[model samples]
Target: MNKSTINLPENTIFEVLVTTTNNQKPHTKPFGMKIQDKQVVLTLFPNKTLNNIKNNKEFLIQFTLNPLIYTKASLNKLTSKDYQNNNILKEATVILRLKVNKIIEQKNNDKYGENIITTIFSTVTDIKQENIQVPAINRATTKIIELLVDYTRYNYMNSNQKTSYINKIIESENIIRKTGNKNHNKSLNLIKKELNIED
Candidate 1:
């Protein structure tokens, strides 16, 4: 199958789980990437995902609705069962194997500050189709993703950054209470406890 088979909204960045292996060891991380010109594109700061992709120019992109998987991935707690053949996330509804086409280096400035981000431009080399059940969009899931992103950097954030980050997390918690499933709330609770945020 081709890019058209994947069928995600164009130009809009979305959350995905990535699997990369180095020396036959698997690593998975939650990240956001957008499709532009049928290419998979994402920028990363220095991290395990970036290192693995730099050493190995291939990785698996997973689309899943399991917030538990996102929680485990964010907390570095994914065990062997979370993966199938060392490359596929078990919860993935759709999978894409991409080959790096180009890498662009650029400096970016955001609320977090300034840093260099390495952008991966990739071509879809293969596709894995599952029983396609497109999930209904929910505000909780999107906010949860953002909260997790800020959670990763929470320790390094200044007072203002930390406040903003925590505020967002609280907002996500509210939405999760109304709209998220048990798994989603579990994920948020895990993050909250890890951050030592009082109820």
Candidate 2:
């Protein structure tokens, strides 16, 4: 088996493309893959990506720091032109092809009240670095994606749980403060306003 070698940050948002059994065009969505040792794991809720992965047994994860892509993807509103230009993969400094290794199911959680979630362990079958230029390390985009994930669960969470996620966003703001550039800061500010979080 080939070993996965990319050292990705824990919370970076990745654009994952999962092919549908009935269609030629692949489904592109934003996801976060956890890297442990030489393996990659994805914790996904019941969604098209999870279901497609179960049937297809393969997926592609792309690493991009573009906040617009993250935002549009989270809303399931990415334009066809975006894919035509290979913008996601091009902007992505690296990409990984993973084959499913294992799937573990987690029971109901009190926090988000999700009935069940699936954790998938996959082996890295291939790795591609689309660009060799200096990659942007700013994490604002990922943090925004994380915040959106939390928002999805907000309806299921209790007051304390919602507060917990809000605090997580606040903590993320510190990292944005450190390495985020003007675009990152602009994105963060917009998200903060949308969330009605006062500084």
Candidate 3:
């Protein structure tokens, strides 16, 4: 796979939906990853996707900016039909099939507690393009992506932090109005309802 073919910048983490399988059932989740050379670096905790990859040894990476995909994945609502042939997400534009190359164990400790973090280095084994779609580098999508990351921590944050994140979400919603598409609106609303953000 040629890394330069993709529009991603040299060192930026982008929010993307990835697919893995547990017992051959396809699962999708949003992740922040960076493409460096021929490998994609992903830092993961002991989640379903990571655990699945540990046993399965590979996963599919979807390259698209549709927030609805993230919404479905975040809500755990992906059905069997969302996948193609039990391996690839049907909505994907450019896809990368990666095989695990390296796994590093990191000992993490904080005010909450200690935990182990896994850093995965996966080499691209196959690159497929169902369609040629540009990777969006706009503020609307960027802010929404940032909000998605923040919402993942909502249940663990204090009330003040939660308020700050909600404000960002509102601001991002406005930006999406000007710069994003209908799918963005639909996905943002789904997430807002899931987060229980009061109008």
Each candidate: RMSD to true structure? 2.2, 5.0, 2.8
Off by over 4 Å in 3: 1-11, 110-113
lDDT of 3 by residue, 51-137 (tens): 998898899888776677777788787787877774677788878888899989899875335768899898777777775667647
User: By descending TM-score, how would the candidates be arranged?
Assistant: 1, 3, 2
Cα misplacement distance, residue 73 of candidate 2 (Å) = 1.0
Q: Which candidate model has the greater TM-score, 2 or 3?
A: 3
Relative to the unseen true structure, what is the Cα RMSD of model 2?
5.0
Q: State the lDDT of candidate 1 residue by residue for 1-199, as single tens digits.
A: 4453567778998888988898898888889899899788988987899999999999988888887888889898889887877467778888888899999889988766887889999987878777577787877777778787777677669998888777777766787888888888888888888877889
Residue 161 in model 2: lDDT: 82
What lDDT is obtained when candidate 2 is compared to the true structure? 0.66
lDDT of 3 at 85: 70
Q: Where's the lowest-lDDT run of ten residues in candidate 1? A: 1-10
- Indicate which candidate wins on lDDT: 1
Query: What C-alpha lDDT do the candidate models reach, one value each?
Result: 0.83, 0.66, 0.78
